[model samples]
Target: MNITINTTVLPHLDPDESVAFYRDSLGFEVRSDVGSGTMRWIVVGPAAQPETSVLLAPPAADPGVTDEERRVIREMMAKGTYGWLLLAADDLDDTFQAVSAAGAEVVQEPTEQPYGARDCAFRDPAGNMIRIQERR
Candidate 1:
């Protein structure tokens, strides 16, 4: 058997805001935008990585989740403790500058990690942690 990763779901309070961050700020392309209302699923990925995408899905999209659960998700997302997406970039400094210029909430400036590689982090519109690592 053979398997490979395709899409990863990341929670979003507002699809439009998250889409703007990923598409406009990070320069990712919208692979697909499906569903409607609070169930919207916007898939975005780096233009070069057409095969992989992150689905910006609304927390209430899950029919199984209760209203209380959805409320909790919204609270956690606001606190920047809900979801995360780690990306690899060619130039850490350039990426950091561009994203900062685009008004993303900077969580950390570019810093070399003790483990190796320099990286930076930011909070998306919904407060999800988006970390970019320098590709070595």
Candidate 2:
């Protein structure tokens, strides 16, 4: 089996806000933007890694998803328990500062973990928890 990790879906209630957060705030490049209205899907990634990208997805926009499911997704997103994205950083402090300064909700400051990583966490505009770990 030839399997490659290409993209991960991160649910968003608003695509524009999520796009701004990932692109302008986190410094990720906008790889693609498709669809329109509430059904938009945006792909973003680090400039250095073009193959791997994160899909800023809108769950409520899917026609197959029921209203009940959309409600649940909204609740989860509001509670900051819906989406997650983990990334690697070259400098954790600088990354944290830049993201925080851009108005992201800071979950944690840059700190050395017992697991041997220096990392930080933040909640994007769509309530997704984005963790950045400094390359060791």
Question: All predictions: root-mean-square deviation over Cα?
Answer: 1.6, 1.7
Quality of model 2 by C-alpha lDDT:
0.87
Instruction: Compose the digit string of candidate 2's lDDT tens values, residues 1-136.
Output: 9898899998877888888898889999998999998688899998988989998888767589898998888888877788888888888888888899998899999988898888999988888888999987
Each candidate's number of clashing pairs is: 0, 0
Candidate 1 residue-wise lDDT, 117-136, digit = tens: 78999999888999999998
> Which window of 10 residues has the lowest lDDT sum in candidate 2?
56-65
Candidate 2's C-alpha runs over 4 A off are none
Q: What is the C-alpha lDDT of each candidate?
A: 0.89, 0.87
Candidate 1 lDDT (Cα, 0 to 1): 0.89
lDDT of 1 at 21: 96
Show model 1 residue runs off by greater than 4 Å: none
- How close to the true structure is residue 29 of candidate 1, measured as C-alpha lDDT? 98
The TM-score leader among the candidates is 1
